[model samples]
Target: MDSSPHKLYHVHGIDSRQFLEHYFSDEPDMAFGDDLLKFPIDSLRQLFTVGHIKGDILIDLSLGCFIHHLYSASEFFKNIIVLKANNRCIMELKRWVDERTGAFYWGHASTFLQEKEGYSDQFGDKEGKVRSAIQHVVKYDPEKENMTDPLVLPPADCVIIATLLDVISKDQDDYIRYLRKFCGLLKPGGHLLLIGCLDTTYFTVGKDKFHVFTYDESFTRKALVREGFIIDYCNVKERTAVSDLVDYKGVIFIAAHKEK
Candidate 1:
């Protein structure tokens, strides 16, 4: 629609179930408890499988629906700081966190994660732990020079930025700039967990179309390395499910660290 960057990632006010289901994987083969969560779940598993990724602070710089990976972090980190794209998303997340009425139905994802983590049939316990682990829900403005102005948070031990990178950036330079900004927020030797859509330049939500920066695995790795992140592990999933909204070819997950 307008030329300004779209705030599609707001977690609140949207039909979370329908929206998430559609975006993640709406195909018959990739429905609930299916392929949509595969890469992310596996990526987190890969992260922990190596060794402990525990830290005091874990920041969720992910695109709107962040719960997909939150459970994995909850098991390791003590506190989680989540950044929202807009007030709606902030409010939406708070509703769930506070157990208020009209909150999005996240039980599916909660259960999905529980099953992934070997806590099958313990959805309530998983949900409670996730709720406890998430400490702060901060608002983020991509245009601001100081994105988190008036909020002086401790540098995070880890920053997990997914899907947002493809949408918030208009060019390679912008991606690099954002990466550098995020990297600056981490403690030395801290890690960055990134997930992105490959070869995608646009995505649609209902009737509205949003922009995404198209790139591949090589570009992603080079961008991270150029922005001062060391590669720890990376996995790329070939595009399988077709989407009516975006024409992305694949998804990639990268775990990296910034050396002192």
Candidate 2:
């Protein structure tokens, strides 16, 4: 039950790089099946295309690998702050942002977004936009009851979270508590873009497996409402693969606003 940093790769997708291509590609595969990436990015693509989100300050709650979804935030936000729960995630992000050797290439995903959003056909435009917009990458501990207990961050106009709640929380109450704590960092009426898994008990990165809090759509909506959020947009996709490596009912994407 030890959720140490060393074992976090089991939850953060470091254990499985091959499955990552599917998360960013429009292609189909049977072995690894579908992951939590493509669907959420598609949902975000829709949300950002409509101009529903605009802000100068945006905070990313988790350093989701291949977060080309940042293409959306970079388009509007002047500053982007990524808060990571695990040091490894932060290091990986820095690797790409700094364009270090052996870093996972993100240009393909960014180019896909630029073309999809009709911004630019040239990939570097979107890539530069994101690279320059990213202002900070710091470690964040969700286990801290007071989310800002140690780090004093400015209230953000928008916050983006993915796959953190389900894997981090011990149970429903812990999930709700963390949700409330994170929402407190958002300014009143600020926007929130969240993505989570549904009815999943566990998942594997490579050789290791990690636990997840299984919850349904109803639970997600209620949790948002309980945390004083007004739902704006929501999308849910049924799990396509039930292999031993990955098992889940679905993935949910919600764009909500903190009630003023």
What is candidate 2's local distance difference test score?
0.73
lDDT of 1 by residue, 89-192 (tens): 67767888998987666666665555556746677777888899999998877667778887877988999998878877878998888888877779998999
Give residue 146's lDDT in candidate 2 (0 to 100): 56
lDDT of 1 at 175: 88
Clashing pairs in 2: none
Off by over 4 Å in 1: 1-18, 24-36, 119-121
Please give, for residues 61-109, the per-residue lDDT of candidate 2 as tens digits. 7534556668777888899988766556667778878988977766556
Query: Which numbered prediction scores highest in lDDT against the true structure?
Result: 1
| Cand. 1 Cα-lDDT | 0.75
* Candidate 1 collision pairs: 11-89
Q: Quote model 2's TM-score.
A: 0.85
**Candidate 2 segments exceeding 4 Å error:** 1-35, 118-120, 145-150, 241-243
Give the Cα lDDT of each candidate: 0.75, 0.73
